[model samples]
Every structure is written in C-alpha cells, then in structure tokens.
Target: MSVSPEAIRSALLARREIALIDVRQEALFALGHPLFAAQIPLQRIALEAPWRIPRQNTPIVVYDDGEGLAEPALHQLRALGYTQADVLEGGLAGWKAAGYELFEDVNSYSKAFGELVEHRRHTPSLPAPDVLALIEEKADIAILDARRFDEYATMSIPGGRSVPGAELVLRAPVAAPDPDTTIIVNCAGRTRSIIGTQSLINAGLPNRIFALRNGTIGWTLAGQALETGRQESVEKGEGSGHDLARERARDVAYRAGVRRIDSADLKGLIADSDRTLYRFDVRQPADFAAGHPAGFRNAPGGQLVQETDHFAPVRGARIVLVDDLGSRADMTASWLAQLGWEVLVLADAFDGPLETGDDGAPPPRGPHGRYKRPYEGTDNREAAMQAYLDWEYGLVAQLERDGTHGFFVI
Candidate 1:
C-alpha cells in the first residue's frame, strides 16, 4: 500500500521522521514538488540509498510525476534491505490533486530558510556600486567569497579571497587581521552572502561587516566586471584568533539549543533503533581527507547548510557534526539547530585511529535532470537572473502557507 499526501504532510507538521523522496530527474523534481520532498533520481537510488538514507527501516515514500518510476524505485529499495518503503499514493498528481503546495528550484527548503533568516534578522547588505567604490579607493576592506573553491576560481570579485561559509568564523581573523578593516562576504547570489555576513556578526567579530547585495549577479547588473582565475584563499591552519572565535561560536550554538556530545553519548544515539542519525565532519574537504573519525562523512559546514536535503533526505533526523576545531562544528550545528534539526556537536578529539579517503559521495552523473541556476556562471540572461531574485523575495510568504518548515532564526 502507498502513503497518502495528507499523511506525509501530517507527519511533517508533527515533527515526525519520514523520507518523502522524489525519484525523478532533478530538473523535473525542481520544477515543482512539495517543500520537504528530496530528489533522489531513480537512476541513482541504488548508488545513493545506502548512505543518504542510511537506516534500513526509515519511513520512505518515493514518488514520481506520472513517470511510473515510483514502483521500481520501491522495489530496489526493498531489495537493498529497506523495510518500511512505500510509494506516494497517486504520485505527484495525487499531491497536486490534494491541493498542496509545490516548491521550485533545487535545495528549495534551504533557499527558503535563508530567505526566512534575512526576513527575521534583517541581515545587512550593501549595493554593488557602493562596494565597488570602496574597493576602487583602496579602502581598508576584505572581500571573502563564501562559495566552493572551484566556484571561486571560476570568477570572483577583483580583490576577493575564498573563505567558504563554514570557514568564515574560523579564518576571518587571519583574512582580515586589522579589526578596523571592513569585511564583505558574497556568493554567486544572495543566500550565502547574507548567511556568511550574519554568521560573523553573530560570532561577535569586531570588524564592520556587510554582504554584497545580490552578490555577483548584482555586480554584473551594475556593469561592474568580475575578475576570473583568482586563486587567493584563506590559510589552512588555526588562525591567531581561534580561541576568541571558538568561544563566540560555542555561545551561538548554545543559544540555538545545539548539544555538545562525547563519544559515549554518540554510541547511545547510534544504538537507538528508534531514530535515524546522520554523522558528518563539517570541515574543509581537504581536512576531511587528511583524517576523520570512522563513520563520519565530509560535508563542508557551509554547503551542508545550503544543501541539507541532499545530505540528509530524511526530515526530522538526528544529526551529529564533528570538527577537530570546535568552532567549525559549533557554527554549523547552530545553523542546523535553527533549521529545526536535532543537531549536536562532538566535543571529543579523536585519539586512537581515523579513516582516510574521499567523502564517498556518488560521482557526478550527466546533467539530465539538473536545474539551470541563473545565478551560476558569468553568462545568464538578465531577465532570468532578476526573476530568480524575485522568486526568492516571495518565499517567506509561501513558507507561511506551506506550514511545514519548523525553522527559527537565532
């Protein structure tokens, strides 16, 4: 028997755990789906299910938009040892017929959550022209790109250095040692820039800070040129101000209700057959490859926040984050907690031995179902970019109507 759309919505509103997965190409899933639906393409479920939905008995509801993919997907899941798998009754059509809301774009919830954060916190931002003027005058300022290294390398602000989201609190001191220097954080578009800037202010950084409004898209619209082939990045080791940043991050985590746990506590969480748990190391990919505790996968803290659905498909799951440096995990856990996750940070430093390798994430597949993000890349139609921003502005109201996201800003 299949699960009904109303049942899934009821579970979500009640904060119960369920994996309402969309087993279609990402593009199709992105076009429209319920707010909490996670896309796990039918072609990749076998490769991804083991880790992405780790627990065998997780309440799994797979659906497809009249594509006849759900049944096969359910079969593969059961063959792989999943016991509570079922199809979403009537598939995507059933969801629509039930008069429920469908969200667009990939990582929809995180994007919506980011909008909620800015809406509630009034995250500060400066228009591109003003920032450009500051830079042209050689003002005492630092531009840190809060994106992946590869994305930063593709194109960046002329003087910007890569200091991805999770790394901001950990490395801001080294990036801009002078307390008086102004700090600007930016991404391809608004979300990361807003989150990164707010993160520093929340962490009690003394430097004056602002997000470059609308990010690179805003800069491009204003006819300002972005520099390409930039390789500057934050230094890898613990910076001089690590202690201060760590303390501030811990405080933020505490305020957001994130718990600090040790190995013994973690063992109990793992043994709890009643709940699903996701373990990740919220450090840079390179740092994770160097060594990490067993069973923890690498998820750079910033991206983890941006792509929570992709990393942890099951809603209402318990998440445990690890970082040798306390601040990175604490900062990430703070955001996770606000996103309504039962998140905790591991305080113990591993002593005995650790596993070393890549994060074991699935290899990238063809762009068959990939959604084209207008904010990405240097060349995008101006109308599409503006429309993307417009879509984001309306998310807060839609979230209110959806009434399933239990997020709270701290």
Candidate 2:
C-alpha cells in the first residue's frame, strides 16, 4: 500500500498518531525530510522498529528520495509486525511536489521549536564580546554552561561552570549564592542556551540572567578563546537552598500544566497498551548508572529537552520522567509540557534499591547522515556557522507556515 503526501500532511495537521518514517541513511535524511519524519534507516528497521514504533498497528508511512529503499523498509516493517506499514506514493520528490516543506538536519522539529520559543519570548541574551569583556573585567558574573558536562569540558567560556539545563534551577542558586551575581547560561549553540536562560527567568531567579548569544559558536566566531578540559561544575546543594529550588521547579512545572504522577497512575498508564509511553530518567548518566528505577531509560534532562524528537519520536505520546532529585524532573517536565507533550513527573515513586546500567534505545548511528552542526565541533567553517545561525533565526516563520507544531512558549 502507498500513502499520498497530502494524506500525511493532513494527518500531521490533525495531530494524529501516525509515524512518517524516512527510510534512508542518516546522511541523506539529514539533508531533507518532512518536518516530523523520524529516520529509521532501512538496514536498521528490524533492530529499531519494535522499540521506536512500539505499537505493531501504528500507521507508519515510509519514504526515501527515490532511493528504492522505501518498499523494502515497508516490507521489513510489516514482517516485523507493523500492521499499518505503507510507502509514500512519490517518495521525497512527491512530498516536495505536493508543496510541503522539507526540514534539514536531524532533530529539526525540536530545534525549530526552540527557535520559535526564542523568537516569541524574545529571550534575553548578551553578545559574546560583551560576555568576554565582563570576564576580563572580573565582573560579578557566573557563566553556567547548560550543555552536558563532557560537552562543556570540550570547549567552553573561561570561568564557566558546567550546569546542564535542568540542573540550572537546582544548582544555579549554589553556583551563584549572591542574588546580585549575574548568571549567564550557554550551550554549544542557541537552543539550549535560549531554553536555559528562559528557564531561570521562568523560575523567578533574582539574579540578572542572559543567554550567551549564539552560544559557543558566537564566541568562537568573535575570535575569543575557549577553555578546554575544564572541571568546574555546580555541585548539588544542601538544606533550604535545594528545597527552595525544588519548590520553584515544581511551581514552574505546575504553571506549565505538567501533571504529577504516582506509582498507581504510572501503572495505569502502562496498562494502556494502546498508547505509546516513554519513561525516562532525567538525571545525569552517571547518577542514572548508579541507580535508576527499573523500566526507565536514562536521558539526561538537558539532552532530552534538546533532542526531544530523537528520544520520543512518536508525537502525542505520554512521557513520564523519573528523577531522584525533584528539581531535575520538574524542570524537565515543565519544558516538555510547554513543548506540547503530555508529560508527567513521577513523585516519590521509587521505593526499593534501583537498577543500574544503560537501558535506553541503542546507541545512535554514527555521523554518516548526520549534519556536522557548526556549534558542535571546533573546526567548522565560519560560513557554515553563520548559515546555521541564520537558519535558526528563520524557524519561527517556518513553524508558522508549517502550522502543525503544537508548541507554545511559556
């Protein structure tokens, strides 16, 4: 069976639980695809289909750019028990012919949504040069890197401490104890930086907060130096500070309409076999490895928010985040809720000793089809970096035209 691009577009606009899968290699898929399409390369279908498209009866439409891979993928999916598998009538060419937009790069929708948030909220930020000058002047400023710790260690602004996204609220108070201390949050690029800065703003932090504009990319572009092998991090706080952070995060989540789920509610949700459920532990990987509730996958809160599409491919699915630290889960859930997810944070759910080891989806396929994001590595060309920033700036207009993203800022 085959599906038309118009049909797929209508389903997406209607917010139906249909999966538009790109059956090409990561490299090609990264080049262009329908905004919501998830890349599950033909070769990895058998390995990934069951886990990614959890419902055997999920309406799945596979496509490729006339690469002759879609039909094979459709067959493989059906053989693997996907009852509603079909191919795109005209493939990628057909979708484009139908005048639907094709988004470039992986996690396109999430990145686009982040851009939309920044555009709509006019999230405050400071240029890298100004930030550098502040550092040189030894201004009363605290730079918190919102990317993963390892990413921060790679190349970060000097004097910047690692405080991954969801950890910002939990750790920022300790990192900048003085309410007067200026807090600057940054990521490799704009998305996490925007989200991180806005998170603090949403949490009602007294400190003056801003995102390092364009993140490390702008810093590098401005001929500024970045520190490598940095070890500074915001350690977990104690007593009233931690409790205050937790309460603040929960309040933010509540405001965003995120639900609090107990073990009983979680069990009932799990029992609903018809719905796709994603249970993630939003703590750091090291913490997750040390101990996490069973049946939950480790997706650090920062990465989970940044890569929501990769983690939870199925739109309209329910997500329950597990975290021993209430602040992390609450903060993560708040962002997820704003991003149009039916998200819940488990409260005091884990009782016994927790399980260890990585339990998430298989490791991501290598960089074959992955776009070498300018914000990621140190060696990207200046043109590519600038071009990436330009693309992000235009995402709000694209989202408006797409008219299918259920995202809302705040």
Candidate 3:
C-alpha cells in the first residue's frame, strides 16, 4: 500500500513504526528533507540497504523530491527482498504542502545548536582571510585542523595541525600547552568546526578557543591558499567504558529530556521474531576498519545521528551502538535515544589501546575515494551559489520539527 503524507506525518508524530526513505541524492536531501526522513540515494540502495536495514521484510516507504524516482526505488527494494516496500504518496513537496516541517543543510540540529551555543556563549571565531593573514605574518594563533588526519593531508591551511574530530576534547589542552595560546578548530565544513570548538568549551579548557569560520570549505571557496602535509602528532586516550559513560550520558540525556533503556530491554526487543533490527557502529571508517562487532555496520556518529532516517529507515527498529571510545558513541546515542529509538552503547572492545595522533586533523577533503556523498547532486547546469545558501537557511526550521534532538552544553 502507498503511504500518504498525512499517514507519514501521523506516524512521525505518534512515534510509530515506519521507515520514511528519501531516494534522492545526498546533496538534494541535504538541501532540505522531512525531519525524520533519511536520505538513501537510489544508486547506493543495493549496497547500503541490506547492511543498514537488515530485515528482508521491514515496512519501507520511499520518496523523492517530486522527481520520478520513488517508483523505480520501490521496484528495486521489492526485488531486493523487501516484501513490504512502498512509496510515500507525495514525496518531499507533498509533505511541505501538508505543513509538516522540512530540515535543511546537513546535520541541521547539531549545526543549529552549534550556532546557538556560539551566540549564547559568545564563542570566538576567526574569519578565513583573517586567519590566513595571521599565519602569513607569523602571528600567535595556533591553527588546528579539527578533522581526520587523512583529510588534512589532502589539503589544509598552511601550518594547520592534523587533529581528528573525536580527539579534540581529549587532546586540545595538549595541543596548546599554554592557556594563553589562541586555539582554532576547523573542519572541511561547519559542523566539525563548531563541534570541535565546543568540545574544548565543554571540557572547560582555560585557553581561548574558536572555530575557524566556515571551516576549510569556506577557506577553499574564498580562494585562500592551502598547504598539504601528512605528518601528524596527536595523543590518544583510553576508552572510558560504556557503563560509566552511559550513567554520565544519562544525566545529560535527562537534562535534555531523553530516556534510557537497559541491555535486557534492548535484547527483548531484539528477540522479536517479526521485525528488522539495525545496529549501527557510528565511528570513523578507520576505527570501523580496525574492528567492529559482527552485526553492526559503519556509519560515522555525527552523520548517523543527523541522517538517522537514511541510515535506519525502518522506523521502530532496534538500534544498538558500538564505539571504540565512549564520548562519540555516547554523544550520538544520546541524541538518537532521545529521538525515541531503542538506543544503547555496547562496551568498547578495545581499552587502553595504542594512541593515534593528538594534533587536530583537518576535515575530510579532496575526493573521498571510498564513499562519494550521493546527494551532492551532479552540479546543476544552471544552479547558482545562492541556492545552496537558501537550502542551508531552511534547515533551521526542520530541526525544530524533528524534535527530540537531545543535544546540550557540557
């Protein structure tokens, strides 16, 4: 049976079982999407679906942005063993017409909260050009690229240190030993920059910290010069256990009005013989590559939480998380758990492992040879830059409608 926008809206509001899939490219989905809808480009469905959804018979509803794509997607899923697959009645436009909220930009809620935090805390940040000039003049600013090390090696602002996203909180103080040293966090785009800066802010570091405005994307777009390097020095820490972190995360969840579930409750739900259960290992590709649980697949934590619908389109499905360390899995799980998912953090398999670099790595840059973001649609022949900005502007309201964001200050 085809799903109507009204039905989808009701299901979302009631927090019922349903997976609303947007069979569009990542770029288009990023432009704007229903709060709970996940973006799984039609092309990657074959490769990603079984890994993400797992259940051959899960009820799956696919939609597109008024484009004639969902029909083919429905056929595709049916062929792939999704017996209950169907299409959304109106695509995204229909939902918009129904007055349901649409979120814009990638990581809408997290990015908005970042902006909110910056405004509320009056957090400091340096514009790309200013930061560039300071570097050229041998100024005091310590430019730390708060992204993955490999991303930094591809392209970076001259002299920026490679600090991976997760390590920022644990390693920032060491990066700038003196409290007086100015610290700047940056990623390929805005999310990590904001998140990295806030990580230090949350950690209660004494130094002045700021996110490099707009991150490396803004830097590259503005025609700023960049440097390439592979050498990185970042100190790593031991895993803080799930049990301890969960209790602490639970407090954070409680403050954000999120709920927690025990392993027993989760297992009982997993035992349900009729449903699909998806366990996502929301850590970096490198971490996932090293070792992960048997049933769990890799989807980075930040992106997983932000684009949950895309990852686990099967609504009401069980989602268990695995992380090598506690903060990322805990933080991401907190958001998803609050969103009314049966979320849990499985204990890390590795404790006190040999550390990786401590320097802030730059954001993933150049071409991700492994996974090209699908929705970054083929550059429109006639699309203007402003269209991109407009898409980002609308995402703020989308985050509001999604509700249960479960993010907060530390």
Q: Which candidate is the best by lDDT?
A: 1
lDDT of 3 at 355: 33
lDDT of 3 by residue, 1-410 (tens): 68888887677666566777878877677667766666677877776777667777777789998789999888888889988888887778777788877776554555566554565566677888888877778866667776666668877777788776655554565677688888988876565676667656654567888888766656755677667665765554334433443344445444434434445565675788686677666667776766665556677765665456656776777677766655566666655664557666666434334334221222322342123432232232223334443454444454565553433443
> How many clashes does each candidate structure show, in the order listed?
1, 2, 24
Provide the overall lDDT of each model, using Cα atoms, as 2-decimal numbers.
Answer: 0.91, 0.87, 0.64
- What's the TM-score of every candidate structure? 0.97, 0.96, 0.74
Give the alpha carbon lDDT tens digit for every residue of 270-366 in model 1.
9999899999998998889999999898899999999999999999999999988788899999999999999999888476588898878888776
Ranking of all candidate structures by their lDDT, best first? 1, 2, 3
After superposition, candidate 2 runs with Cα above 4 Å error: none
Residue pairs in clash, model 1: 27-369
As for candidate 2, its clashing pairs are 26-369, 27-369
Model 2 residue 88 CA deviation in Å: 1.9
How would you order the candidates by TM-score, starting with the best? 1, 2, 3
**Model 2: worst 10 consecutive residues (lDDT sum):** 362-371
Top candidate on TM-score is 1
